[model samples]
Target chain A: MTATLPGIADIHHAATRLSGLIVETPLIESQELNKRFGGRILFKPETLQRTGSFKFRGAYNKLSSLTEEERSRGVVAFSSGNHAQGVAASAAMFGVKAIIAMPADAPAMKIANVRKMGAEVVHFDRVREDRMTVVRPYVEQGMVLVPPYDDPSIIAGQGTIGLELVRQAKALGASLDAVVIPCGGGGLSSGISIAVKDASPGTAVWGVEPEHFDDTRRSLAKGARVTNEPGHQSICDALLVAEPGAITFEINRKNLSGVVAVSDQATRQAMRDAMANLKLVVEPGGSVALAALSSGEIELAGKCVAVVLSGGNVDFGTYAEIMAAA
Target chain B: MTATLPGIADIHHAATRLSGLIVETPLIESQELNKRFGGRILFKPETLQRTGSFKFRGAYNKLSSLTEEERSRGVVAFSSGNHAQGVAASAAMFGVKAIIAMPADAPAMKIANVRKMGAEVVHFDRVREDRMTVVRPYVEQGMVLVPPYDDPSIIAGQGTIGLELVRQAKALGASLDAVVIPCGGGGLSSGISIAVKDASPGTAVWGVEPEHFDDTRRSLAKGARVTNEPGHQSICDALLVAEPGAITFEINRKNLSGVVAVSDQATRQAMRDAMANLKLVVEPGGSVALAALSSGEIELAGKCVAVVLSGGNVDFGTYAEIMAAA
Candidate 1:
């Protein structure tokens, strides 16, 4: 049986709930990028979002949806970085306590930012332990789990980007030919896809993933949820999810035109180009959509495309290292 | 005789002329910065402006001011980096050729960007050959000189930021107590100062400069124009101008409340902090006003302040090295 998924109505409701609580990051475009692509290229920079990523939309929505009694018990979240920061900051905003389970090797800045927000952090060896296993105890203790991309509320929350972008693109006199988003568990991708499809049905929505970790792509290929082999790796720590969340996968499969995977090298080059041309500091995962465009994975000539820069939470040393490489 | 300088009406006219030609770059603020300063801090990031700096406003204004016959003869500009890129891009936009005199040691990216816009570049030894000497031949050949900051049109063009920020701040429900600008030849500072003082008389407009290159600060102190010593140095390549322009200095002396000088170390720290918290790629010169806030050069306790990030054209290698340093 097909389960009911969050739709445009839920997304609109979430937008209302998130009004003034989240930053409606401006849709930006560079003249050079537009000229290079031979088309209008619009960027919705969620890098400028609260917590430096789009995760704040879902985090704040989830927090707002919590019962007052449930909030007292606190929220538990499993994240690589951006989601942890979002939950921590959102919880702090609402006077709710947050506990985040993060990989030990997550970028130092992300971890420090989470701690700075007064959240309790539990570190797990990403190679050895599953984040779900780490958050089980907190769940058993009556804390609401704000899964990164699984819940309907989170999906609906992240879908707000799709709503804002369509309107913003219209305001800027651009009718997008397609929209591309970076994918991990497909929460942000699927959420945005659904809204984009609903608002502008002619526009195509595609998901991009790292070459080494293409669970979402493979899942779409196989017509079902699939897990990645244990040894795959990439610098996009935030997008290393082994598989797409079941709820997000179903929506993504229905709404997304297709899924494409890109190389770390390509993503790195796009990050550098963004620094040089767009004046934005995009993280590895957040840059994958832009990578897809720059790497010529998708044909952009004569077509206006909107690419979402999902997050910017890379540590200084790591970012420096990326930019320094030839 | 007192010279008739550009005023609010001139700025309003320029804004009208530049209606759709420029990017109305959003004013950004960081919640983390607000907490650190114990007050609201807004950032007008002209780093995202076309050509990656606020210079575009002035450059485009100058380009638009040329008569049809004058436009056919093309334009010439002398700059450290940002102004050259702006003039190049603006000239290209107007379908006119440009000849730029740039410092030999200007950031590679800036020079490349100017050439990319189909402008001719002539490099001069910044330590020996004065930029005026470099551009004198072009002006003599009948190319209209677009002096970086000295022209009345340029100051009025830069003053557009003051109009935008004050309106944006009020829309965000913030009443700014002060506005800080990164100063070079004082065009942006003095221009913004006039507008802010005109629109919000109670608001204090301040100019920030590198410790060793604070010509505007010294000029204000001595009640006349002053020049920096040749041996003094800083990493703010875009802001190494030795003296304020005649027109700009006059406006600055009348409008600005005060000027402050910050150390390179402070500017570097602000650049790093902006990358981490605001997810922005700020160049050395673009970061000075923000540096003034972070370095505690000015007290921000219980007052709302606005800082303008003037440019972002630092090469990736240089930026990476800055981020790598302690």
Candidate 2:
């Protein structure tokens, strides 16, 4: 049976549910960036969101929808960092227990933050072990599983950002020609695509991925699901998903304008530029959409564009190294 | 002759003048910060302002109000970095010529950005040369002088942020107990003090300064203007004013709750914490208000507080050093 995807109405309901619960992150415009790119570029900075990522939107929406019995039983989730912290914080907000399965080599800061948020974490070697195996025991114990990007509720939740963006743009008396979003499992892109396309049918939605793991790009081009080769390396740990989710891929295939892939070096350069120009702390994964714009991979001259900075959960050591190199 | 300071009416007018010219920055709240401090804290991030600082507010207000003759003759201003960039950007926006007198040792990025914004920059020796001496020729040539923070229009412009905070807090269904603002020449603090005090008469307004540059704090305590001892060093170069402004001090003396001083070490730590928790890039001087709260110098435990992060024009080298040290 095919998985049902969340539509515009579900996203609208999610927007209502998320009011005051999640931050309505600002749509910021940079004059300097506009001059350089010759486009009116609006940045939807989820970096400023609670837990420093948009993952909080989905996590909170999903966790709050659970029945009283399910809330007491708790929830299990797996993420490298951003989603892990999102789940931990959201669970704590609803007074539910969260067991997070994270990779052994996940950023130390992310791991510490998850624990600080009162979540129990189980670490697994990403290279040698499957994350699901570690979380299976918790799921067997009747804890509900909160998938990072595959669930309909999660997609609808992230779509709330798109709703806010459309409303904010209109209030500013501006209209978007296109919107670029960082893609991992295609959840954020697909969700935003549906909402933005419905609100402003003229706006195109594009997904950006790291060069090393362009599974979503390949899948979108081929009109089928695709997987990345193992052992490929990238600094964008957050976008290291080997393939798009089954449900997410279907939605993205229908709604996305196209996909763009950016190099690790380009991502680093975009991070440095963001620090210098936007005064924002964005992770490498979160910088992909910006990288695509800055590198001219997406031509947006004289057009009104919106780029979503999906997260900012980088460690000091890694951030320093990147800034130092630049 | 005594100069007249702008009042609440002037600030409201400035708010109307700056409707689309300036960014109405968001008042951000962090759950992690609230948990650590045990109080609701609202952060007014002027770091996201046009020139990465609130200096733009004052500069734009002053520049936009110039007469046609003054605009044709152009304007001259002195600043270390933030104000220089702000003046340059505002001048460019109005198509007016700007001669910026900046310190030779100001961050290279700031110097380059001033030039990139189409301003003519004249470097001076911060230790041996008075900036006014270099700009005397321009003033003699009929160009108007724009003081960084001493003028009524400048202060009135900065007060627009205060108006926004009061309105935003009301919409959020919250009221502030106190507002802590970073002190440089007292322009931002004094201006915000006037607006916030008038809008929310019950809320207290406090000023924060770097430990080495506690002129404002000492002045408030002594009930008279005081100067910092020369040759003292601080990483908060933006707040290195030796003494508070003549007009600014008079206003602050009457309206301020008090002034608090934070060590450079505390400021650095706060910058790191801001990057980690808030995902915002704040400079040393800009982080002082948050530093006061983090160091427990402001006593914000159980009271709703608002802190202004005034700038984010730090260079990568300096930011990397701080991050590496942390």
In order, what lDDT does every prediction score? 0.90, 0.90
State the displacement of the C-alpha of residue A274, model 1, in Å, after optimal TM-score superposition.
1.1
Could you give the DockQ of candidate 2? 0.90
Question: Candidate 1's chain A scores what TM-score?
Answer: 0.98
Candidate 2 lDDT, tens digit per residue, B1-326?
Answer: 14498899989988888899889999999888998999999999999999899999888888878887788899899999999988999889889999999999898888989999999999998878977898999999998999989899999999999999999999898898999999999999989999999989889999999997999999888988999988888899899887899899989998888888999999999999899989999999999999999766666778889999999999999999999887
TM-scores of the models, in the order given:
0.98, 0.98
Worst 10 residues of 2 chain B by lDDT: B1-10
Where model 1 places Cα greater than 4 Å from the true spot, the runs are A1-3, B1-3
Q: What DockQ does candidate 1 score?
A: 0.81
Would you list the clashing residue pairs of candidate 1? Answer: none
